[model samples]
Target: MADHRAALRAVVTQRMLTDPAHDLAHLDRVWLIAQTIADQRTNQRVLLAACYLHDLINLPKDDPNRHLASQQSATESEPILAELGFAASEICNTQHAIAAHSYSANIPPESPEACILRDADRLDALGAIGIARTFAVSGALGRALYDIADPFAEDRVLDDQKFAIDHWKTKLLNLPAEMVTDGGRDLAHKRVTQMLGFLEIFSEEIGHPLPINWKSV
Candidate 1:
């Protein structure tokens, strides 16, 4: 069982590494956060495996078919797990967890492992790492940092963000409240506070008029 689990992890980790959107480091962060949150009542193996492999299907960052990609990834992951000698039940649970990880998909996690995986994935979107990913993804999609109109509009699609900074107001700032696990929520509170502080300071700096001596360097 242990060998099979290790082999499965290796395969998925490699896939994640090669995938641009949800890269290997994202998987590592999810596993780290999952480990911190998982308890005696939770299945660590299931949670970690799910966290690492949830985004195996490389969906376009702006694709409207987000749920379809998640479902496809979940469906494809089962065969890999079965080939790696995972039990049928374990494979099914992992598939469900993977399928439910995406927030835009809106599929609620049904098990403890799934909940932990969801929370861990969300935690990756919160603090310093979250900020980095937001910009990385935004830059990859050629989004600007701010738009004069509809800066905080929730109805605006992912492509509508003129800049990466606008994403904080659109989605990133709202993630903490949606987290599913207690540990995830705790970590999210600190990270959210950090993000809010950054935004406040940024606004103050941008709002103030530049001094005459402060020439462009």
Candidate 2:
């Protein structure tokens, strides 16, 4: 397993896109989280492979073909899996997990491994790490921290594409409800609590304290 992990890391390091929010470190964290919440029946090997390669074909968030990235990654991983000595069944399962892990992919996770992979990956989009990632990606995309006039979108529709903070209300804060596993949900709630705390301080520091209703999960 150590050798396989090293091999996967090498492959990822060689091929990962130059996105701060989706680097090798992100993949490492996702794999770690998946292991932590995985059930006894979960296949660690498949989960590990999927976690490392799920973003194999990384696409810009605003790309019209963003929803297809996961499926493309799944296809791209086939030859790599074969080279890594994966069995036919293992390769199939691994590809399915990778293809279904994306939020935009809209593919249902049919196996426990796929569910865990999805939950773990989404978990990365919450808590302190999640906050950092949100800002990092937003900065990369040339978005503002928040709308100055109505930071909480009080007067306008939420638009994460233009404002980083709007993403919390639009998606990040809502992730707990979408978690597939009980463990993932529990962890997501804890992470969201931290995010809410950050939002309160952020609002106050900017002289635009959020509405009381916007502070909780």
Weakest ten-residue segment in model 2 by summed lDDT: 208-217
The candidate that wins on TM-score is 2
Clashing pairs in 1: 144-162, 144-163, 145-163
Q: What lDDT tens digits, residue by residue, belong to model 1 across residues 122-213?
A: 88888888877777788778887655453333345544446777667556777777888888888988888777666666556566432222
By lDDT, the best candidate is: 2
lDDT per residue (tens digit) for residues 114-203 in model 2: 999999999999999999999999999999999999999988999998999999998899999999999999999999999988888898
Candidate 1 CA-lDDT value = 0.74
lDDT of each: 0.74, 0.93
Off by over 4 Å in 2: none
Question: RMSD in angstroms, all models?
Answer: 6.2, 0.7
As a whole number from 0 to 100, the lDDT of residue 208 in candidate 1 is: 41
